[model samples]
Target: MKTWILPALGTLVCWGFWAFIPKLTTRYISPMSAMVYESMGAMVIGAIVLAVLHFRPDVSGKGIFLALATGMLGMAGGLCFLFAVRSGKVSVVAMFTSLSPLITIALGYLLLNETITLKEGLGILTAFIAIYLFSAS
Candidate 1:
């Protein structure tokens, strides 16, 4: 058994909590606002970790641009997810969004010429099935 199993289980629990976050966010605030808050919280935590390690922070122009671009993409995705959850069943939206790994795999294949193993291919297919089953109801 992998020693990482406990951490993986903890992550799954956290992910479960995150699934309902869109609904709660859409109820009380704009998705963009929620994403901004989320990003800020992430940044603060990262900064704190670095500080505790006595690491010097680098705010180069390239780093700033990359961070801004990532934040923009995150905000866009969050808004769309919030809209989906508000307009449809949360379980359906969550299941559909779980297919994001497929997007990542596709991008890696296109940009890096990466090859998918049979197991990964099967996982993608199963994700599709899960999406279809969740959305059909």
Candidate 2:
């Protein structure tokens, strides 16, 4: 089996829940409040990982900086998602936000010189079309 399959499936399942649980949360509290509690929940998980790793994680200063920056960007996006879910249909919001991979593809091509094959390019185009159709509903 491919090594990435299990982790990819795990992401699919966890994020399926992740996409859902927040909408449920915003029902009872403000988006900002929900985000606060959400961050706390994530911290608990992080704490467990730290303990499992014996409080030692492989690191470098640049890697640490990049990781922290990633967290900040994720949190910023999460806050935006919270507000979006609060005001928009979660179905549309979730589907639309899920297209974030397009940005990654663009960045990979532009910055990392990753090649997109014809099939992958078609996939990207199809994804954009799907997004338009999905949002129009």
Best-matching candidate per lDDT: 2
TM-score of 2: 0.97
> What TM-score would every model get versus the actual structure?
0.73, 0.97
Residue 40 local lDDT, model 1: 82
Each model's backbone clash number: 0, 0
Cα lDDT tens digits, model 1, 1-137, are 89999999997898777778778777887776777787787789788989987896667999989988987786678668877887677888888887887888999999999999999899888888877887888
- After best superposition, candidate 2 residue 114: deviation in angstroms? 0.4
Q: lDDT, candidate 2, residue 129? A: 95
TM-score of the candidate numbered 1?
0.73
Query: What residue pairs clash in candidate 1, if any at all?
Result: none
Question: lDDT per residue, candidate 2, 1-137, as tens digits?
Answer: 99999999999999888887788889999989988998999899999999999999988999999999999998899999999988788988999999999999999999999999999999999998998999998
